[model samples]
Target: MDRTTDTTALPLIPRAALFGNPRRAGAQISPDGGTIAFLAPRNGVMNLFVAPRGRIDAARPLTDERRRGIPGYAWAHDGRHLLVVKDNDGDENFHLHAVDRETGAMRDLTPHGPIQASIVKLSPRHPGEAVVSHNARDPQWPDLYRIEIATGRSTMIAENPGLAGFDVDEDFALRLAARLEGDGSQTVLRPDGAGGWAPFMRFAPEDAMTSGVLGLFTADGRATLMLSSAGRDTAALFRLDLETGEATMLAEDARADIGEIIVRLHENTPLAYGVNYERNRYVALDPAIQPDLDALDAAGIGDWGIQSRSEDDRFWIVGAASDTAPGVAWLYDRKTRALEKLYDTRPDLADAPLAPMRPVVIAARDGLSLVSYLTLPADGGSAPRPLVLLVHGGPWARDSFGFNPYHQWLANRGYAVLSVNFRASTGFGKAFLNAGDREWGRAMDDDLLDAVDWAIGQGIADPSRIAIMGGSYGGYATLAAMTRNPERYACGVDIVGPSNLETLLATIPPYWEAGRSIFTRALGDPATPEGAALLRERSPVHQAARLARPLLISQGANDPRVKQAESDQMVAALKAKGIAVTYVLFPDEGHGFARPENSIAFNAITEHFLAAHLGGRAEALAAEEIGRSTAQLLEGAEILP
Candidate 1:
C-alpha cells in the first residue's frame, strides 16, 4: 500500500494534534500566585509541567529523571515545589517529591516506596507546608502528614485512626480531620496540640452527610466549618463552629451536589467563594463576587486561583477555557472589574468551531431513564445516520454532559453519538453504584443495548449501521456487545479492553493487588478455585465464537493495569479459530495511549474501519499510509475482522 506523503492532504486530522497536546491536562494556577503548571506528555511520557510565575512559556520539567516516569503532578502550597505522583501504571505507590520550581531540582520526600501518598490539601498561604494522606503508619487508616517543601521532611499531623479526610483551619493548622463512619455522620477530629487528636466539636453526621461540608472558613482570626448539606440526602450550604461545632444553615443551595466550592477571604466576613453547580455554571460567591468572576470568564480567563488576602479583596489571578479556547492565564482586576486575557496554550484551535455539549436523556430498557450529554455536528445533517456509541472507560464511572473530544469527533463525522450512563454508575449514590457490582456482562451489557434501542426508537440512530466503541471497561463492553449480540452491532472497536475476565482479574498489576477486595465483590471470588471459572463465563474471550462481526483490538505493551498478554492471547486464540480479528500492539503505552503518535495512529485505523463498515465518509491516514496497510496487516485473522 503506497502511504500518503501529503500530510496536509490527509482525510482526517489527528485529534491529539488538533487538541494542542495538553501534557499535564487540566493545568491550573497555584494559590501562591507565582507559578503555573499543567499535565502534559513530554518526550512521550505524561509528567507535570511547570510554568513559573510571570513567565508562562518559561515552563520547565518540575520532576527529575523519574524511574517509572511521573504519571501525574500537583502543586504544593509554597508554589516553590511540585508533588510528582506515579499511579497510572497500577502500583499506586506515589513517592512524594518536593520539586524546586525555580531550579528544577527534585528530591523524594516520602522515600517510602509502594506506599500510596495522596495529597488532600496544599496550603495556598504557607508554601512549604503541605497536607497529604499516606498509609505510612497503618494500611486501613491512611494518616495525614504535614510536609515541609524545603526540608523534604514530613510531620504526621493527624492519625485518622479511622477512614477520615482533613480540612484545614484559618491559622493553617490541622483542625478538622473529618472521620467517616461506614454508615454515615462524620466525627470531626480537632487537634489539641498536646500531641493528641480529639473532636474539637460535633455536628449531626446526618447533617454533614446531607448538607455536604462546604469548606473551612476563617474570619475574625477564627475558623468555621461551612456545610453544603441538609438533613436529607442532598447537599446544601451551612456554616458550623470549628471549636464549638455549632451549626447554621446558609442560603439553601437547592442545586445540591456542590460542584466545586472556591472560598475567597474577606475582612472578618465571608470570603469570596465560587460554588459551581454540576461542574457547569457557578454562583458568584455572595452575589458581590459574581460580577468579578463573570467578567473574568467573559475575558477568557481559563483558571481562577485566588492568591492572597488583600484589603481590597479584588485583585485575583484568573485562568480560562472556552469552546475554542484552550487553557489560558488571565488577570482579573476587581477594582476595575476588568479581565485581561493574558496567555493561550494553543493559538491554532482559536477558530476551530468548537461547540458546547447539550445534556439529554434517553430511556433505557425496563422504562428506566438513562442520561447522556450530546454534542451535535457544526455542519448540521438529518437523522437516521450512522451513529457511534462512545462508551466511556469506566462502566462504573458516570459520563457527565461535557465537551468530550471523542464525542466531538463523532459528531463532526455526521453521526449522532450516544454516551450512556449505565446502571451502577457513581455519583448517583451507593444504590446505583452497587446495582452494577455483580452485573458485568448481564445488566451492564443490557444497558449498552438499551441505549441503542433508545436511540433507534427516537429515530436518532441508523437501524442497519451502528458501531460500539470504548476504552477500558468501555472497551470490554464493546467486545461483549459484539460477542453476545453479534447481530445488533455492525462492528466493534475495543481499545485496551479485556477479552477474558479471569485473566483481567488475576493479571491486574501489583498496584491493584489490594483492589482485589473491590474486584471480588464486583466480579466474584478472586482467590477461590471456582472464581476463575466464574470469571471465564463472562469474558469476551470465552464467547469469541459468538461474534460474526468485524473486530478491531488495540493493546499497549507497557499497560501495567491491563497488560499486553491479554490482547495477545485472545487475538491469537481468535486467529486460531479461523476468525478474522485485527490486533494492534503499542509498545510505548500502558493501559491507554499516553503519547500523541500512538493515539493518532490508533484513532486513524478506528476511523477507517468505522467508515468502511458504517458507510460514513472515508478519511485517509496521513503519517502512516499503513492505516489500511495496517488493516490489511490483520486480514487473515481467524476471528471476524
Candidate 2:
C-alpha cells in the first residue's frame, strides 16, 4: 500500500498517445500462415492491413474505412478473403463485409439493411461458405444463413424460433440452440432430425448466465462441450454426451469460471483452457500443446495469449501485454521455437513513465470480497494523492488486469486510479454474480463506496479530492455515487450511462427481445407495480436534486443501447434544478467513441475538468484537438480552458 516513489519529475504523457489509434493492433495470421492481417491507421482512421509473414514493412491497407474504423475482422478458411463487421455510428446493427485479399474489393455479404449480422461459424471444412445470423426476417429473432464468401450469395439455413443464440458445427450445420424462458431460465435444444428441435438440457434461472452449451466437441456431433454451474458455484468445462445427456467435467476452477477454451483449428477439439481470478492461468489439456504453452510461459512476456493460429498449428500469432505496456505481437514458430517480434502496438509508449497496477481484494461492508486494481502515480512519494474510482461497464463484466489506457492516463496526470470488480461481475462463481441481481444502485454502489474506503484506509487516496468516472453501467454508477452520497466525491463523469432504468428497458433494441426476461430479472421489471417502484427508487435521474458534486456527461448521439436521451434527460434535470453540468455530445458516435479524435477530445476536456475540481495535473488543451473532433459542447463550454 506504500507508494513512496518521487514520480512528480516525469514529463506529462500526451492524451492523444494514450487514447488515440494504435500504430498496429489486432494481428491475425492467415490460415495458410503465409500472410498476416492487422489493423493500422489509414488516413487517420483505423483500417485493415495485410503483409507477408515477417514483412510488416511492406504492409498495405486492405480496407479503406474513412469514417468509423472497422471494429473487428477475421480471415476466411481459404485465406484469400477477410471478413469484417461494421456498425453505423455505434447503432450496433452490424453488417458483415467480405474483402478480397487479391483484388482489394469489399462486398457487403449481408446487405439486407439495418439488421445486426454476426458470423456464427467459419471452418476449413466449408472453406467456400460461412454460417451467419441476422434479424432480417424478424426484428426480434435472428435467422441463420449459409453465405458464399466469394459470390455474396445467401441461402436460408434455419429460421429462428425465438431462440437467444445458435451453435453451429464445423460443417456449418446447426447443432444446438438456446432459448431464454419467461422466468429467466435457459433451455438448450437439439435438432430432432425431422426439421424440429427437442429439449437437450435445461438450466435454472440462477445458472442461466453462468452456463450454456459451447459447441460440439467432436466432428461426428455425438458429443458436445459446455460450461455448467448447475451443481457447483463456479462454471466448469464439461464434455456432454449428446445421446445420453450425461456431462463429464473436463476442467473447473474454485475461484473463477472456465472463461476461455483454446481449440485446435478445424477439428474443434480443446487443446487448452484459461481461468482468470487475480490473473489469467492457462492449463494445457492436450499433451502435444503442453510444450507450446511452456515456451510461451518461458518467453519472458507478460500474460500472453494466442491471437491467431495456422490450420496446421505450426505457426501462431501471440500477443503479449502487461499493465504498464500496450501490446507486442510475436510470430511464434513451434518447430523453430523462435519468438519473432512483429510489431509494438504502441511504440510511442515504450519509454513513457507508466505506473504499475496492483491487484487487491477489499471486503465489502456486507463481508463480500471485491477484487480490485489500483494504479498509483509513478512518482507519488509517501503522500496521499487525488484518486479516481474508475468503474467498468457490463455491470455484468468484470475488470481484469492489463494495459489499461485510462489507468495510465489518470496516473500520469497525478491521480491514483482504482477499478473494482463488484458483485454480479462474471468469471467469479455464480453465487457472487447472482448476488448482484437487482442491486444496481443499491449494493453495487455500496461496493464502489467500500473500495474508495479501502483506498483511503490504505493512505492511497485524498478522500476529499476523489472523483467517480465510467461509461455505460459504470457511468450509471458514477451518477448514482454523486447523488446517493453527494459528499463522498468532488466530481463525476458519465459517458453514455442511463439515468432512468424504466426507459432504458423500454427502449432496448428489438433483437434483444429474446433475452428481455434476463434483463427484467437482473434489473427490476417495469411491467409489475413492485418492480416499477424498485426501478424508480434506484434511478439516478430522480435524485438529481441531491447531487452536490460537479458533473460532466458525454454521449454518442447514435448509441442504440443507452440512447442520447439518457444524457439529455440527466442534463435537463440538472438544468431545471439550476445546477451547472457540462455536456459533450458526438453526433457521429455510438455507445462509446470509436474515432480516436473524439476520444482524445473527450479526455482533453475531462482532464481539465478534473484538474479544476480534484486539483490534479492536466495537460493543456490544444486547438487542433477540439478542431479535429466532432464534439459538440451542448452545455457548459465555459468549464473548459
Tens-place lDDT per residue, model 2, 403-485, is 99999999998899999999999899899999999999989999999999999999999888899999999999999889999
Per-residue lDDT tens digits for candidate 1, residues 1-641, read: 22211222223434554533553354555655555666555665555677764576677765544323565566665656767755434334566777677777878777775676876765456667777777867654677777777886788876665535666654456655665543334556666678666765444533433333444556553556464443433354556655556676553444334444556553224434433323445555477767765776565443344432222344455545543345565555678886555455555555555545666666666654566665655554445667788888766566764446676666555566778777665444333455676678888889888878877887778778888999999888888888889899888888889888787876775434333455666776756667666687888888877888888888877676677777777787787788888787765567776545566667767777776677664355564533412222344233223
* lDDT of the candidates, in the order given: 0.62, 0.91
Off by over 4 Å in 1: 1-11, 23-72, 86-93, 113-115, 124-126, 135-144, 155-256, 265-279, 296-319, 322-329, 353-356, 428-437, 499-538, 558-560, 563-577, 622-641
For model 2, the run of ten residues with the poorest summed lDDT: 1-10
lDDT of 2: 0.91
Model 2 stretches astray by more than 4 angstroms: 1-7
Instruction: Please list all clashing residue pairs in model 2, or write none if there are none.
Output: 6-379, 7-379
